[model samples]
Target: MSASMPQKRYYRQRAHSNPMADHTFDYPVCPEEMDWSQLYPHFFSPMDERHDRDPDKGKHGVEFADVGCGYGGLLVELSRLFPEKLILGLEIRVKVSDYVQDRIKSLRAAEPGHYQNIACLRSNAMKYLPNFFTKGQGMVYTMTDVEEVHLWMVKHFTEHPLFCQVAEEDLVNDIIISRLGTCTEEGKKVQRNGGKNFLAVFRRVEDECK
Candidate 1:
């Protein structure tokens, strides 16, 4: 590895974190109050100057969120895949999140004008997803090696009124689906272990009541 690249050994953490634990996390009171410029500086302007400028000028919100993003493998890949879209990775582990942040910084330093659309934040997505994202926005992509977990996710998402599973035929054209199993660190580990991966993609649909 290059001297600038982050070493994975230095940022090791347990596989899972207790979401129920009382972890002190700073979150925005509301979505509008959140300052995204710090996360995606290339996409957004400073908060102070934003209000005075054109609403359409240098303003973009995170369109794709990788919840529990471990080591930011997907974020790096998606940066090259979707240079036009802003991607954010939310990881709860402090060391792991710091490693990802450093990794992005090194990559940006190594190659200028690249990897600016990607960023990582230390956040518990389960507790603060609503605080960062508004209702009826973005798609959810989930994959797991455990059959029980996969089934559980399928049951909950399929049962939800606002979320509908994307059809297999429809997923054929979406390049993001192809990377789910190949891009992430966990996915690479699963592949090395000769494990099977079950994937489900869901999109938000318009509510009839609205």
Candidate 2:
């Protein structure tokens, strides 16, 4: 590994975190209150300089979010695959998220123009997801080695009024489906141990009541 690259051993953390636990985390009051420029500097200009550019120049926001993004594997890959789109990774564990942040910094330093579209934030996605995204603006992609957890996710998402399970046929052309199980660190560990992975994709749909 390069000297600048973050070593995984230095970022070790417990395997599980209680999403319901009270952990001190700083989050934006709303999506508009987020200072995204700090995370993705290339996507935004200084506040004073924004008026001189096209209205759309700095209007881009994170379109893809990887919840519990371990080691930022998917974030790096997504940055390459969707160079024009902004991606963010949310990890709850402090050291693990710090490792991802450092990893991104190293990647950006190694290749100046390539990795600017992706960033990692240390946030509990379970509680803060809504604070970062507006209604009808999120898609969920999930893969896990635990059957019970996978089933639970499927059941809840399928039962939800605003989310519908995406059919397999509809995702045939989507390259991201293939990466869901192959890109993350946990996924790789499961693969190495000969574990089976259950995958699901869901899209947020318009509520009829709206």
Candidate number with greatest TM-score: 1
Model 1: residues with Cα > 4 Å off, grouped in runs: 1-3, 51-60, 207-210
Q: How would you encode candidate 2's per-residue C-alpha lDDT over 1-210 as one tens digit per residue?
A: 333898999999898788888899999888876777778777776545543134564465788998899889999989999987889999999999999999999998888887888998889987898888876776778888999999999999999987888888788998998888888888889999999899888877762221
**lDDT of candidate 2 at residue 88, scale 0 to 100:** 91
lDDT of 1 by residue, 1-210 (tens): 233898999999888888888787888988898888887676677788856244563355778899988999999999999887888899998889999999999998888778888999888898899999887777789999999999999999999988888877878888988898898888999999999899988877763221
What are the candidates' C-alpha RMSDs?
2.9, 3.0
Worst 10 residues of 2 by lDDT: 49-58
Candidate 1 residue 194 Cα shift, in angstroms, is 0.9
lDDT of 2 at 199: 88
Q: What are the lDDT scores of the predictions, listed in order?
A: 0.85, 0.84
